[model samples]
Target: MENLFSHPESEPEPSQQDDDALEPFIITVVVPTNVSHAFQGFTDHPHLWWPLDQESVFGEGSHVEFEENLILETAEDGRTSVWGTIDDWQPPLSFHASWYPASTPLWSTEIRVSFRAVEEGTEVRLVHDGWEGAEDPAASRASYAEGWPRVLERYVRFMGGAVA
Candidate 1:
């Protein structure tokens, strides 16, 4: 469940004029399953592993659903929120999306997740980019940098990893 690759520690500040200069936040983790199963576990059953009760737009008692073109999070109270839009979806391989959870699409970033076969299991690599759309890209990236590891820890545990 450890990252086999790492990026540079120092990253450039993102600006609307120079958005492409900012490097995407990349993280990789190996899951104890094949590519297809890992892909299904992430796209089809996020509600089971995602920390919906804690880090979600609807707060506690929310569940996620990946629709044809959207990722929806619905609360127990019946209110729903759009987390992202599926731009490109290729099962058992990779998918790209515009992510804007808890906000409008106008301020969306981008996410790409890929699943590849490895010696141990499937290597799930996540790349978060497109900071130009955010009002405060650096802050958003920093926040997610802190948050994604925890979220992926939950996912790794769900994927049968001995994650502590």
Candidate 2:
């Protein structure tokens, strides 16, 4: 049975292809807060907004936080997982990080989030890129495309804003 599943010894190497053909996933939202408050809410209060029960390594009781240069998720039992690391930590303006939830840094993707004060409130933009680094760039991008919007909706609600 093991031999039946093995690849042929004469199989040719796969061709190298450009994964950058996939565009970055971008999302923008306006919240009823100033830029500074928006940034603070995103960075300092993710534990309150994040859907830990649905999107966590330990589920339900797990909480996530941004500390120093790392985004960490800690379970009720005290076990922690690193979801990502901060590549840039500018406040009230923008921040960049490499996100790799439930995966290794070797397959990481880049995330950049910016906040700007607008007439209505604050404009927050998120760009998730670097698809070339992902193991299955298209599938990875698709999963995040579905997941990020839900996550951002939670953030928007936490900021006391409606998704328009």
Candidate 3:
């Protein structure tokens, strides 16, 4: 079967398309580092790149309390959870997480980040799958299609020297 999560020919455009049949959205970002350092920064230093505006589910060392093995994010007003249970934690090479939206049934696809060495830097490939069950799969894909670029751009800049 074709990898639904493979990078599409083009990013989803909200206006021109129906936004109801958009398929997998893949985003790959290259950063200046080897596999080891890239993996380290991705998991250990998430706070540096994770949007500060959003609440965090996992901090320095919070206990996993839920039966479902999820990381909970709470604020004064509301709470949300994005799949945080670690599927694989091998360092400096690959890591996978369940990418499920909080408040939804646990239908998750693996998000695998691979680090490979290149002439200029390490290529970070982020693939978020399991989109078939999303509430609005097309809309979700569209949103992520646009969002990943911005997030990756921030990640690249932050890695380069921009402060959070």
Assess each prediction's global lDDT (C-alpha) against the native.
Answer: 0.89, 0.90, 0.61
Could you give candidate 1's per-residue lDDT for residues 1-164 as a string of tens digits?
A: 65778776899776774554456989999999999999999999899999876679987678998998999999898988999999999998999999999999999999999999999999999999988787788788888888889888899999898775
- Per-model clash counts, in order, read 0, 0, 0
Clash pairs, model 3 backbone: none
TM-score per candidate, chains pooled: 0.85, 0.86, 0.65
What TM-score does model 2 achieve against the real structure? 0.86
Q: Residues 1-164, candidate 3, lDDT per residue (tens digit)?
A: 87988997898666755543544566777787666777677665655665535323444333222223443444344444555566675667777766654434555544677788888677888876667766766666766676667766767776663323
lDDT of 3: 0.61
Instruction: Estimate the TM-score for candidate 3.
Output: 0.65
Per-residue lDDT of 22-140 in model 2, one digit per residue for the tens? 78899999999899999999999999999887777889888899989999999899989899999898897999999888888999999999998899899999999998888989888
Worst 10 residues of 2 by lDDT: 13-22
Error of model 1, residue 57, in angstroms: 0.4
| Model 1: lDDT of residue 17 | 42
Cα lDDT over the full model 1: 0.89
